[model samples]
Target chain A: MQRSNIYILVFSAVMTVLIGGAMSLTSVLLKPAQDKQVELDTKKKILGAVMDISTFDKPEEILNLYKARVKSVVVDIEGEIIATDDKGNPLIAEKVNAQKNHKIDREERLYPIYMILNELDPNVVEAYVFPMFGLGLWDWISGYVALESDLNTVKGVAFDHKGETPGLGARITEEKVRNRYKENKKIFSDAGNLESITMVKGEGITGLSMHEVDGLSGATITAKGVNKMLKEYLGCYQSFILNTRGLNGIAIN
Target chain B: MSAEATVVEKELKVEKKSAEPFLSKRRKNIVTDPLSDDNPITIQVLGICSALAVTVKLEPTLVMSIAVVFVIVFANLIISLMRNLIPGRIRIIVQLAVVATLVTLVSEFLKAYSYDMYKVLGAYVGLIITNCIVMGRLEAFAMANKPYDSILDGLGSGFGYAWIILTVAFFRELLGSGSIFDFKIFEAIGWATFPTNGLMVDSIGAFVVLGILIWIQRSKSGYVEH
Candidate 1:
């Protein structure tokens, strides 16, 4: 049957209303759950840098573990602690969004440092986790790099991406790939210069030096992005590392 | 009043029975033909992009298949229910609206309940909105068929698409990673050093596997393209 213009218009209008209503309703209802998921994922990634979280399948368990073993502090480029935000609210490092901070001026950006404490004794710091953000081949990539208490060696690393080609650039998330950075890799050279770990071109190369790791075979650009990310972020944290070392030395004396 | 209502219901049931049984042979054919003879991927050649993209891993491919099936079935049913009122000029628009709504719902639900799967599927989940198979079945079958028949058609086409991609994934994951569903099968069989085919892990590997599948299926079903 021939439908009049008015009829078509009405039909379209009704469809628009219905579709809009449904999508909005779904978004509103799922927003809380989705937000929680994002929070949990961030915690997981942060914790993943220092320890294996794969076995902790329950969200509550992971959250509980994070609460017990992790403490966070927000630091600036000069490694000074920022106690409050511009509006004077107490700054919580865990609540800081790394991606948003990544776009601002390096000097003004707030960096979150997560301290992983020794499980048996909370007084002893096990490792320090730093969040890194940079551009990948296709889109933004971020990672968590954990430094042992010595402030020189990389304890572990966890990488994530917004959009990277699967099986190639995306392999950065794989344990096998991430292990390249944890194989006795040192971020600081013997001369005490902060030479952040680098992902070299090509894969399966033996006898990698202290500051070098094997790169993804077909993902040279992504590997470079990761290298730059580590270097840039670690450079920002250079003062913090040195300061902490000096403070520890004084405490020991 | 109750007696009269019962008589009316009985007459309606009789009329439905006379018109067509619920599981008629033709209706069964509607749900089965797409599996082989009228396969959506191999024969209709619809939705080949996802077939090549997600088939690299069995786990993600299975999730993708279920998501597609859910979208198609519901889209088909909703469209078929409104088939009569949908004006021909605005039919495509209406169909698109319905399919997009369903796809969004699936994507949102995945994000909420299964965030890990959501991460794994990534943009591919959103890509389901543009999958031609969902739109194709709606236009070709749902627009004219009964709601129940449209659902069956959706199932047929959805499974038709599912099986082909699953087969592709099976081979790709097996050869590419030496694993099934991420289980290191070769290692379990004491072949810890099984050399996986690097090509099979790539997108090009999906094309080769899908091509071989299409060839085998077509030859078996005696379907020759004119």
Candidate 2:
């Protein structure tokens, strides 16, 4: 006998509810674990900006290194400390989503800075890590770019992407792309001003320049996005960077 | 759901169970055929997108393989159980929902437990819902077969797809990075001076490897497509 239309409709409705309920429950139940993973991954990326984490084969080592050498702080674009925990440490910076903060007004947005400590002098700051977020050709691309103690030269970089093409723009995640930022100063230009790094797509970067780095060969648009993100973010942190520099007894241009 | 469909289903032999072993001849064929002559990637050319996408590294390829097995087996079992109740017109929708639900759950599990692989696999893991192999097996085999046999078929096809991708990944990782599963074989053996082939890391590498693999497998099995 042929089944009635009502039977099919009822079956679909019941199936939808059942599947939807199961999926929601799974997502809710697993949310904590997923969040932890995200936090750990973010911490690793933050640490990666200051040091070569390629040798860190163990997750526990990364966490331990992060805790030992790194301090998290939240700051406004004006360079003022906004919030800190009971111990006077910054609220876990990983908890603040960079992608979300990238949207909305810049002054209202909370920026996270991971301070890398000197090995010998734990109290001394070795570098300041800044989380960067911006649009790629397809979707969001995010990374950490660390500035040295001088607050001028780039210490290192670690980038990740959502939907960049595999052989092209997605090369941002490669060590080759990241390492190009090393020793390239983003803050202090030849004219001695706070000009962020620009990615030069074409060649002829033979001269040693602090404000420019070679871009990925086939990823000009993505390179431009990175340049834009770095410029905008570094601009936001200018006041804070100048304050920090002034405190170090350096005269600002 | 329809007289014509039921009429077509009768031509295939459903084995009679008696004192037969758990792995019967027919069941063995269900699992093993796809590994060789009936291979999904090589013979049928199914799920090649992921094969090219995730096979850049052996680690992610292995994870993708396991994820596909989980998705396909569960989807086939569920579809087979609901085969009798699903209306003919909406069977495709039902299969899609079942496959999508399973893929999402699997993706969530990967995110929660294996975040690194999840990141590496990225959007490809979710794209498993669109994999023709999952829907193909659902419609062609699961709808007419018992749950147990359907699951075997799923496992067979999943493995078939997995091995080909894994093989592609093995070559890609080895030649591209001079490593296997990130072991850096060349560096370890003092062959660090050897220049790694950059081409092997690109998606084109996957195509080249899979194309050669298909050629070799087909020639060996004498299963020409002509």
Candidate 3:
């Protein structure tokens, strides 16, 4: 045991304790900022799907632009519109008997965002935007698909995921893959015209319905999940779409 | 916590101790080890996780390669410099602490300055610490060499690792993305950088890069046979 060696051990130990402690503290301090950035990024993406903003790329810029155009509302499962704050009543007054909140399997509680823009002093383009939950190759995937006043023709759409292989199946987010649903692709009509988006063996999906998106090749499971999610959630919004369209003479189911 | 600490304490009556002096041997150890047939990635087969993940596009792979090079080189130098001052039992812990700190700082710089590139890198930047080249150098050679030589040794092996990684990334990004560093070389993103030259961006681009690399390596010097 040389005297120099004794000094070396103590120095190393002290440096380790100091360095590790500092690294851990920095990460903890920065965690909030990082989390906020992540949240804002997702918010920007959501806002972008409902509105076309080819000019803006930054989230803060998108948020500013959205402030002028979009108003979010929480809605019930039925035709009646709930207030923004949900303060006035627990149940609907006019259709109190018709609306059902008692059944456990059929709960009335759900969150959906509506996009409203005032075109004229009295006229407005108000449409309810909702989430489409589905499955992809690896896990549960979800998306936001907006509809026009018609409630059938898509205004815009955005999809994201939990996990999918990078090059092969994860191409669902790519423009070409998503454009199928975005191009006035009808999801709902007088009847559920397209029961589900097509998840077929090969590409080139001819006229089945306007809403059907051809599944990715070698990614059938994910494609099926997307179809199933779109069908079920779109079904939930049917009554709201019908009520809003009928009031405006939009002819929705 | 043993008789040794007690005996050393009793003999020197010391408060703090630094690492052992192993710099000369470590310098030679790291420098000679990787260049030989027993290279870490090639022979020992370390760090292939990053190889696969970043190799898809060349820019990410190149960034990843450069990051590993920086971490390995500086960590080796810092570890070697402090080696003589490290405690015998806690040597590995000390090495890891220093290496981890350097990695975090470099990762932060990339994140704050180059946001787009940072997004592409994502978790791979932090994963540079897990790169065996850094640890392998610290443990095998960095802990024993003098700071100057140890740093050189660290960089030498780092270069050894980067040479292969960059070569791979170069081919992958160019062919895969139709340009290196995310630029479309045939058509400019806008004006100055990559003004006229932009390469096509597609999946097949990656396949072409991989094939060309395989072809180039095979057709080159005797080094390809290995």
Question: What's the DockQ for every one of the candidates?
Answer: 0.57, 0.51, 0.19
Q: Write the per-residue lDDT of candidate 3 for residues B1-226, one digit (tens) a residue.
A: 6998889886664333233244456556656666544455654556765665566566666777788878888888777877776666767767777777988976666654554456566566777878877888889887776677777677667766666666666665554445666666545544344322122233444444434544554454234535
Off by over 4 Å in 3: A1-20, A51-54, A57-60, A78-109, A114-123, A126-128, A132-140, A193-209, A218-225, B1-46, B56-59, B73-132, B146-150, B153-183, B187-221, B224-226
What overall lDDT goes with each candidate model?
0.91, 0.87, 0.62
Candidates 1 and 2, the one with greater TM-score: 1
| Model 1: how far residue A2 lies from native, Å | 4.0
Question: Tens digit of lDDT per residue, candidate 1, span A42-70?
Answer: 89988998888889979999999999999
Which segments of model 2 are wrong by more than 4 Å? A54-61, A84-93, A183-186, A202-208, B1-19
* Alpha-carbon deviation at A171 in model 3, angstroms: 2.7
The model with the greatest TM-score is 1
Candidate with the larger DockQ of 1 and 3: 1
Best by DockQ: 1
Compared with the true structure, what per-residue lDDT tens digits does model 2 show for residues B1-226? 6987766665333333444578999899999999989999999999988888888789988998998999999999999998999988788999999999999998999999988777777888999999999999999999999899999999999999888898999999999989999899999999988788778877888889999999999999998776
lDDT of model 2 at position B187: 92
- Per-prediction RMSD in angstroms? 4.2, 5.2, 9.2
